[model samples]
Target: MIRHIVFFRARDRADVGRVLEGLSILKTIPHSSRLEVTLNGKVDQLGNDVDVVVYGEFTDAAALAAYKAHPTYQESIDRVRPLRDVRMAADYEVTVD
Candidate 1:
């Protein structure tokens, strides 16, 4: 399985809601086995730079690719890019015995 995780910080703290609203569109896409958008919660004692989080699980690399290829993915980017201060993403394969 492929695990997809993305973190984002808004350019302005007040715009965090807008960023979340923008990312909400991704839920409409049907490619991933599971997908979610959430707030950072900022519970860590050291780092709270990230404001938004996107987490997804895909059956395989191809599924992950398809999720990215989905048109809503671009819409999410177009809407969030301008309001975001930073964006970070990581994808890794998960082995389930």
Candidate 2:
């Protein structure tokens, strides 16, 4: 299995709602074992700057790649990119016991 995680920081606080709405499109993507989007609830003591987080689990790299290549996903990225100040993502294989 593979886990894909993304963190997004909005350029303007007012854009958070719009950004979240755009990102919600990911949940409609197929082949993901799990997909979720969350807004930051509280300020971090360490001052972490992320405003939103997207988490997804896929069966394998190919599944993740397909999700990324999906037109809806691409459209979501296009819609949200302009509203975000920074975006970061990571993907890794998960080992099950």
Candidate 3:
């Protein structure tokens, strides 16, 4: 299994919702077994720099790749890239689902 996690920070605080909305486009793509886009709860006192989060689970690298190759993925990026200051993504393989 592959776990895909991405952290995003909006260029402006006011645009957080827009950023979240933009990333939501990913959910419409069917390549991932599970996908989510959400606002950070900011429960961590040490750092609250992250504004939005995208979490996805895929069966393997090919599924992950297909998710990225989906046109809506580009649409999401085109929509969010300009409004975001920082975007970071991490993906790893795990034995457990």
* Winning candidate number (lDDT): 3
Off by over 4 Å in 1: none
Q: Write the per-residue lDDT of candidate 2 for residues 1-97, one digit (tens) a residue.
A: 9999999999999999999999998899997999999897757798778988999999998999899889999999999999999999999998967
Q: For residues 34-95, what per-residue lDDT tens digits would candidate 1 score against the true structure?
A: 89999988999999999999999999999998999999999999999999999999999999
Stretches of candidate 2 exceeding 4 Å from the true structure: none
Give model 3's TM-score versus the native structure: 0.98
Q: In lDDT terms, how accurate is model 1?
A: 0.95
Model 3 lDDT per residue over 1-97, tens place: 9999999999999999999999998999999999989999999989999999999999999999999999999999999999999999999999983
Cα lDDT listed for each candidate: 0.95, 0.92, 0.96
**Which regions in candidate 3 have their CA more than 4 angstroms from the true location?**
none
Q: Is candidate 1 or candidate 2 better by lDDT?
A: 1
Candidate 2: worst-modelled 10 consecutive residues by lDDT = 40-49
Ordered by TM-score, highest first, the candidates read 3, 1, 2
